[model samples]
Target: MSSSSVVAFTLGASFASIASAVVFFLRARRQVQKVRGSPDQVVEVQPPHPTWTAGQKQPNPFGHSRTVSFRSTDVVGGSCYPLVISAYIPRPIALVSTISKNGVVNMAPFSYSGAMSHDPPIIAFSVCRKPGGMKKDTLDNIEENGEMVIHIMSEWFVNAANLTCSNFPPEQDEMKTAGLTPIPSVSVLPPRCEESAVQMECKLHSKQDIKNAAGKVTATLILAEVVMWHIHEDVYDDNSGQGPTTVKHDNLHVISRLGGNTYGTTTYVYDLPRPDRPKTGRKV
Candidate 1:
């Protein structure tokens, strides 16, 4: 073959290879774009702002002019009971039932009560001394017997529960005065309120006496260990194949003590999903 013809054939083959390579590259790029969706549909996401900061001052929704501040001494020492109660807006009410040494059943409601532990099941309540620094009948009964039943008050029996708080004589039965039926408790000497949806049979664990500056006992804090739980069938959620059993808040209609003469009920409910952190060490 002639030298010029050989060069021409080699150059034509090189040009064809370059054209094929370019077409293959373009097709691969198109496939990558298809897997990632349309380029124009892509939206840029921005991180959310931090809700709180250590030293940064946030915008005051109520404004500085509307804010009020007071010293702790002023509320505690002075006759500022309202301010003190307002600090703890909502508190659970415990209808404590106890039997005196003389076999008199006593029932009284105390707002200073809540669950302190769950593993061993512990509940606490505080009873303030009555006029002339006299110990309350509920406190006296628990001291003698070391056994009591704590009842959670629902909307149906809130009024009756409050009636039990009256200053009745030790001989007078407040449970009967309130028109509440008392059912025998399983593991305690004190009877449980039949009207209550939930009842806890507890044994007194410990008692702490809170004294004033003059060393006079002002209140007694009782810690009790729950031995048995009696939940009404309607309020009890026995998981049984359905998810974990939880007290239906709506059905329970639980009541809470507010400041002063005010009381509140659980009527509104909302839920928010918990955010999960990213594996890349980014906060959710």
Candidate 2:
């Protein structure tokens, strides 16, 4: 072959080899992902430290590490969000349900939620504004109706619940589209998810807008007063009139939110009782 033809052939061969390598790399990566994301992995719940006592040291005590800190204001909100969520470990998820004045039902989950009081049964959740400072449908519905039902997410119905997180139009009913059954709540206008093990019917007590350093409202913190509760019989433990009521963990199958697209299950649990006050301590 001529010198020019030889050069052309060499270039074509190199391009073919490069393409083949890229295809192989992509296939291998997919296989690795499938293995890591497999749902068949057996989840055996065990005590974190079976043979531990009070004031016991960690197994790898000598492997202590130095602390690294960052100034909150120094980091931007976008970067700080992932860092805080990941470092905060597992947080409880609130699958809040609300209905607009036009009767459009909405459902979505939020990780920034928790119970604040027990006497009046107050709970709070914070909803961050979207890009361009736009309010989400959930926040708008709650502000319009002042009623919501917070449900505890469970393992069985988590897939369906996740589907409701999509940014659907306000005219769409997320509960129906996600294939979840909604039942009328006794004390609230918003419906409750039938699949949830624990549901709290609450009315908006008050709301506070959170501002950033730039004096712009970044989110809204809503405080809701639960007027009624709907607990599934399988997860409820009346204690037969003997002790305080509780929930069955195994039956409840409660799942919590982790950083990114991960979730945590309550497979392993350990109890630690509070120590009695020292007898030598001064009493008022």
Candidate 3:
């Protein structure tokens, strides 16, 4: 063959080989994509990099600025006063009712209350000193009688419950002032609010006095054991004998306290199932 014809033949073969390799690569890629699922449905996986390793400061994923730390003692109102009261997000409200030694009825609202145990049914609440460093009426009554009833605040009677928190005199009836009806309890001297959907009769189990740096009492922590529980039928779900009576959140419409004068409600709800761990013996 002529030299010119030979060169042209070699060039033609090279181009054909290049085109065949390109087609095979694209076809293989399509097969891999099909096995993995749709590209749009796949979530991008992020593996830990050197920035996330120990002793290495990782950039904020939330784009937040550098955080400033402060000691609780250095703060004006103490570390717990603001950090716990405000930064704690949402806290449940406890509408407590107590009776004085003279049979005077007193009712008040406290946000620093929660359940501490389930076996013996224990609950706890903290009460701060009133103005002029005097003990609160609720604490005084509880100390005298050793019995009180705690009612859960719902949306239907939240306003009335809030009114009970006012600084009323010991002689004044906060239940009457708030227009809330009080009914006789089954096992306690203090009455329960009829407006509340849930109520618990509690007897004093323990009491702790919290003192400040000056060694003066600043708050009282009361731990009580719940003797009986009263739950409204509307909020109780039997769940077809599968589990305990589930309190329907939507039906209860419970209200919670936030920072300052803010409040939260259970109107918006969502559920996310927990992911299962991989079978390779690694923690998820």
Candidate 4:
């Protein structure tokens, strides 16, 4: 029809819609009040659940004697025996890499690699103090040069990673003895391992001293920013049909720390996404 007639009809419809929206808003507000902590009714909200853990507190079965002398040095560096801590430890994807500072190179595996934050690409790990508990060369390189290259362990490279756990003087290159090839790092002084399936170079953002029950700084928890990552073509699906085809978890043959000197691997594995839980519930 006529333009004026159409305009009048549109205005009427807009007013009706506005009135309906206002009525809906008022009803929703009243309903929200009615359910606000009504004991008879419960709002079901599936909150985020932990993937790894929500901070662990494991009592060490392998801890020091109740002797209460307090100084581990007074007893033995062999350790108080079995630490209850092993039960809570996770199966880590070890990173075996060679790091350097002022020409001094250190090779080590860090089981503590974990995604602490995703936005800025932060990874965190606890660098245990050297047995007899000294700061390791890896830590020194990261602290002295403020850079580190982390390599992924695999079936082909785990043997070398095992060899790296040995305590050797700083002068000797562990990578050579471990049977690993030294490759150049993208953003650090240390060389990444060409033999490793994957690698990431990181820059130090912050590190804090970790003290024992005796208040001695025996370890350091390091938080670093991943500046670059080098994933081997064989490990990921590039869809170009040019990379290594299959990688069995068994083939990777990872080594893990068990109680005492015992090491373990993936004899069996199962995967399931973590279940969601209520964040605010008391769980009574």
- Residue-by-residue lDDT tens digits, candidate 4, 98-181: 456558667887665677885687778778887677888878777777887766566555677778878888887888888878
**lDDT values of the candidates?**
0.78, 0.81, 0.78, 0.64
User: Alpha carbon lDDT of residue 110, candidate 1?
Assistant: 86
C-alpha-based local distance difference test score of model 1:
0.78
Candidate 3 residue spans exceeding 4 A from truth: 1-62, 65-83, 272-284
Query: Which parts of model 4 have CA positions greater than 4 angstroms off?
Result: 1-81, 96-98, 131-133, 238-255, 267-284
Best by TM-score, which number?
2
- Model 3 has an lDDT value of 0.78
Deviation (Å) of 85 in candidate 3: 2.0
RMSD of each: 20.7, 15.0, 15.8, 20.5
Position 23, candidate 2: lDDT: 54
Q: Candidate 4, residue 83: CA error in Å?
A: 2.0
Instruction: Return whichever of 2 and 3 wins on lDDT.
Output: 2
> TM-score per candidate, in order?
0.72, 0.75, 0.71, 0.59
Could you tell me how far off, in angstroms, the CA of residue 79 lies in candidate 2 after the best superposition? Answer: 4.9
| Highest lDDT scorer | 2
Provide the lDDT at 235 for model 1. 80
- Candidate 2 structure lDDT: 0.81
TM-score of decoy 4: 0.59
How many steric clashes between backbone atoms does each model show?
0, 0, 0, 5
